[model samples]
Target: MSEDASLPLFPLRTVLVPGAALGLRVFEPRYLDMVRECGRRGTGFGISLILDGEESGTPATPAGVGTAAVIEDFDVGADGILALRVRGTRRFHVRRTRVRDNGLIVADVDWCADDPDVDLQPEHALLGVVLRKILERIDGGDQAFPEPHFDNAAWVGWRLAELLPLEQTDRQLLLQEDDPDERLAMLLRLVDIED
Candidate 1:
């Protein structure tokens, strides 16, 4: 973690993963400051899952695993508010979260890296099949999402694990799994693969 851990936190309803893209509209004063500070320092900001509480109030607990995001785009609203587009660069595990007088949540976190040799489990091949079918069904309607982008079996499982509308706890479980093989296996169960 960088010394910039002192900066504010923005825990969201969703959990983000590394190499993922996220878009956010900044309006509140505290968050605006957080975004500006991150931009000025060229440091990433932590994104945790908001378990409970409104944006203005402090969440009782935020999921420990989160991603550090970089601002891809930002603009000033006519109302003088800021809107930002953020992309996840890497994943981190939260050590602690403290609310500041400025209404900002600061969390101490440590980075996470996937094991180099952990191959995507064999069970995930079935998940690929199911995911393709789901995409076909989804693309038939206007509510379709972008086509799945995957480089390998492991990445495919990860991409689906993030994009699918699984519960927050499920997403956190996937994030905490250090082995790509096990992650892929878990993904299979989520998609309900026959084998």
Candidate 2:
């Protein structure tokens, strides 16, 4: 992990993983300012899972680990709301956080390193097949995935983590894990597949 750096935080009830795409509707003034600044600088903002409180009202307790989200697309909705499509870029560990006057949470975070690439093994073949099937069912299918590395352990693990019907906390745990192999193993245990 790198040395701690400051980032604007957005806490939600969901967990986002690197390489995942998420759509958000922004109305809060603090968040609108965050979006504008990030757009102006071509930078990203941090998204952490809310451990307590609510997404709309006051500042919430956030999970320690978070993903940095880069805006991929933006538009003004018919209702005059800002709608944004953001993709997760990297993972970070929050060292500490402070609430701004407008109720936005800013954090000092250390960037988490990407795990070394590992080839999928025979034991994990079932996971790869299932992931393929799942992707095929998505709206854009393979086109949406774009060059997915089903043979790579980390990529496979992240794809499964994002697609699985797991609870937010469960997904958050997977996102926090640094070891790709261990993450895959844990996913295997959580998913029950029969012949």
Model number with the top TM-score: 2
Q: Which digits, one per residue and each the tens of the lDDT, describe model 1 over residues 41-138?
A: 88868787777776565544667777778888888878876778787766777777787777788887776765455444455666666667656666
Q: How many angstroms is residue 104 displaced in model 2 relative to the true structure, after the best TM-score fit?
A: 0.8
- The residue-by-residue lDDT of candidate 2 on 1-195, one tens digit each, is 246689999999999998989999999999999998887887889999999999988899999999999999999999999999998889999998999999999999999987788998778888899999999889987787889899999999999998989888889989999988878877887887624
lDDT of 1 at 9: 66
Off by over 4 Å in 2: none
> Candidate 2 lDDT (Cα, whole model)?
0.90
Q: Give the TM-score of candidate 1.
A: 0.80
Q: Model 1 misses residue 88 by how many Å?
A: 1.4
Query: Which ten-residue region of model 2 has the weakest summed lDDT?
Result: 186-195
Which candidate leads in lDDT? 2
